[model samples]
Target: MNETISNSPHQWNTQELPVVVIAGYGPSIGESTARQFGSKGYAIACLGRTQNKLLDSVQELKASKITAAAFVTDCGDTRSVKEAIQQVQSHLGRISVIVWNAASYVGSDLVTGNDDPSEILNQIVGVGCAGLLASIQEAYEDLKAMKGTILITGGGLSGYDQNVNQIAVNNSWMGLAFCKSSQRKLAGLLHARLKPDGVMVGTVIISGAVRVGGGLDVTDPDDVATAFWEIHHSRHKQEVHLGSLTQLASEPT
Candidate 1:
């Protein structure tokens, strides 16, 4: 492990601290995951496209007395993703967990059909599959050294297709659904390939809506984050469906 902290946030050799790199740092899952890991003494490397958002998350983490730094990068770009991982490793020591929670679609209008089909497909795949591949490739060595965990955020779309009307189905959403399914498959493949090497890969497939705020709410981001932490520690279960799985199970097919 690289026992060299550039800034040295905690006074001690901060490099000795376990690090977690959140690829898609955001208000929901990303923030919650950071806090969850930070509470457990993990240094956080938050990667996102928006510097302000990244800074906000880092500030909150620091306010909570957690060592954190923000890295600005586009997860959709493989080169950027690789560079971000290298930078994180250089600054924070070896990474113990990396959460790929950066998703592209935000419930916008879907263009199920487009004149430039290839362009749209590339955009979706870049965020979903390509970015993940780049991150995994770059972080594989570091993860292997620490026996790390790779946690992915997934939606209920991967589990089952909803029966909503055609007008309600946005093309972008359909694309996202496809991307979610692809991510799940990729996660399974990664788990199969890396499990033997002691690198745990898992996906937390959320079933319902995620909300902000605190308390004992099951759908709260903080609570959802616990599932992610559990998934990493468990190491045995490759996939965990939170919120929606039971509803899906009870529904008539």
Candidate 2:
């Protein structure tokens, strides 16, 4: 095996670039994260359910002269997640970072409840929790070797759901809050287990509405991506809250 040695930490351009796997590759944080890491010279492997979406992202990354590839898989399925991980390893080498950004938001009314609560919960658990578990399991060895990081996209509703005022204002957000709350807990659990093994696990909680175009308080996906990279680079924070509500002196009780 041949390895490049660098006396200075700043000398990374000469070494083999690390790989970043962006699961649930979409136009929002997924795409931005890919571009952010890719611009830094890391190989990008995008995983998404839609081939067209993945291909478009890959093409855009390639156009920018970044090494990029895409894998199509349903993140909600463990078998599919494993298969995609294997393919990513085969095509892009060991992953140095894993970004879990997939979630199912069916807009199910929590007051009346969905026609099938089981299905909604299943989907939520599958994407928000199960998929993250499977990816970490498959990437553990590689991540441990590289002392890598896992960044999760969390929602503000998770923390806000407990607030009486927030709940009174929008009862429909309960289902999303439940799933996001679970995901945040899962990230914390993973951080506790993996920190000793040199894997950094963190989640960025967006405390306001996220949209392409919105008010000053709305969370921007690009900013969220930058925050993800900053957390990974620092490896010092377990969680970060974005937007007005979270940036306030007191973020929900």
Clashing pairs for predicted structure model 2, backbone only: none
lDDT of 1 by residue, 208-235 (tens): 5678864231377887689889988888
Q: For model 2, what is the alpha-carbon lDDT of residue 48?
A: 83
Q: Per-residue lDDT for 1-253 in model 2, tens only? A: 1111112223222345798988888988898898899888898878887877777777777778777777787888888898888777765678899999988775446557446778778887899999889988998899999999999999877774346236523545556677788898899899999999999999998876677654666888888888999999999999988876533324432
Q: What is the number of backbone collisions in each predicted candidate, taken in the order shown? A: 7, 0
Off by over 4 Å in 1: 1-15, 106-115, 160-172, 213-218, 245-253
TM per candidate: 0.85, 0.85
TM-score, model 1 to reference: 0.85
Alpha-carbon RMSD to native, per candidate: 4.8, 7.3
Model 2 TM-score on a 0 to 1 scale: 0.85
lDDT of 1 at 124: 73
Q: Find the 10 residues in a row with the least total lDDT in model 1.
A: 163-172
Pairs in steric clash, model 1? 110-170, 110-171, 110-172, 111-171, 111-172, 112-171, 207-244
